[model samples]
Target: MMTIMRKSPINVRAAAKEASHERIVQAAARAIRRSGYDGTGVADIMKDAGLTHGAFYAHFESREAMLAEAVDRAGAESNGFGARVIAAVPAEQAFQALIQAYLSKEHLAGIETGCPVAALGSEMPRQAPEVRRAATRRIKEMIDLVARQSPDWGQPGVHERALVTVATMVGTLMLARAVDDAALSDSLCSAALKRLAPSDA
Candidate 1:
């Protein structure tokens, strides 16, 4: 006779908890992305996830906690965007690849799937402290990556230059999304990229 091995109940419970938490986070991210931070509510997010509001406290302390998680998710999603471009091109060409990809017609039209910085930048300053902190960290991380691609920038004032670059990218993308004229959208992206382009490039 052979004896069968059984899985630990603790491991199963942990996996279930992780899956539930991830589902809630994803649902919150979608809700917040479609509706700005102030416009969305805990109930709405819970409803979207098909979970009860009572269940929320099991994973987070309050709405602010969930918002922080959502912001972190959005930030990660936004920053990871440049990875594909950076991988395909040399570091010298990385910035150009980013500019082109970000300014492209497809990106301009795809608001739901586009960069969160471009989608939600105007709303960041108004978010709760925790959410704002997450946004700040993500923004800094992205800037550091861009500065790394630009060797001449040095390390001292990367923050300022990164702000300019990020601002240009977000502002132009927002303007492109707001307008009805295709030509105007294209021009806005082109002009912004030119302004933010590195001096050496």
Candidate 2:
């Protein structure tokens, strides 16, 4: 016979608060992606998270503060996905694997969970300083990861090349998503993949 243990009131309240905060941040992250930063609202986020709007202040001081955390969360998730792709492939194939995964149709249709760099790059300049800084840091981390897999790794220009490569990929994806024609979207991604990672083509 085992006795069941119950959480103390203090522990229960703390746990509930922590869970609510996580829900808010996660909802914000998804909402911001579905509707750009300027479009996502605190009330909408709270509603999506299944919480009352009045309870928002208990977790975040302001909407801007929530947006910053949302941006950071999205960026971290993007970085984590890239890291997993790189890790699963051989060192020599890591770059190609990353490019393929990034430009795939699956990623194109899944914007809500896709790369924040491509989704939010154009809007970064218009966001709060904290949001921009958080995104910039994550973008740099992504570039560095690509640079490590470059043929010119350790060479002086590898970092610059990595920047160009990442920029091209992000730009291509953005353009692809903006177009109305399905063929055009496929063409954009195909062209970028062939041009940037020809060896993998």
Candidate 3:
């Protein structure tokens, strides 16, 4: 027989449902970053995803489930950005590139699409355990990425340096976004870059 069989209705329905689920998660990721965890609502996320509020439960068991998935997506996006920044440079410059990108003006102004750690760190503890765990996992991944980039990687103090580097970058970005003064925001980013990057940077 030369003819091919079409996908079964059950498989098609499953695929469609999976696509809707992804749309909901992506929308929630941006929503959570734009509006902190406490501010993001299931209805808003569903609307943003072009779905009805009633469809949310079909994809997630609860609001916390959706938020946890959103956190993971947001963290993945940030990690991907950092990875791209590091990939653009030589191994020796990876750490500097990461620091520069994290504290860049573009990042400072792009809060909704930027690092979840900086945008949501303060609110993490107040979130449900699943959400907190999701954030913690990503934060640890970030720290580990920085550690691998450190010149002292595999040495005794590299992990500590990575911890400080991640903390400073997240803190600087948070403050830069928190301040109302544009001058102070720019200064915060610049000062962080100067202090955290290699002396040559």
Best candidate per TM-score, number?
A: 3
Model 2, span 60-144: residue lDDT tens? 8888899999988988888899899999988888888898899999999988998888888888889888888888888889899
RMSD of each: 2.7, 2.2, 1.0
TM-score of 1: 0.86
What's the lDDT for all of these models?
A: 0.80, 0.89, 0.92
Which ten residues in a row are the worst by lDDT in model 3?
A: 192-201
TM-scores of the models, in the order given: 0.86, 0.93, 0.97
Per-residue alpha-carbon lDDT of model 3 for 1-201, expressed as tens digits? 699989999999999999999999999999999999989988899998999999887888999999999999999999989999999999999988899889988998898899999999999879999999998999999999999988789999899999999999999999999999999999989988898995585
Q: Model 3 compared with the native: what TM-score?
A: 0.97
Q: For model 1, what is the C-alpha lDDT against the true structure?
A: 0.80
lDDT (10s digit) by residue, model 1, range 34-62: 77778779888888887887888988998
Quote model 2's TM-score. Answer: 0.93
Better of 1 and 2 by lDDT: 2
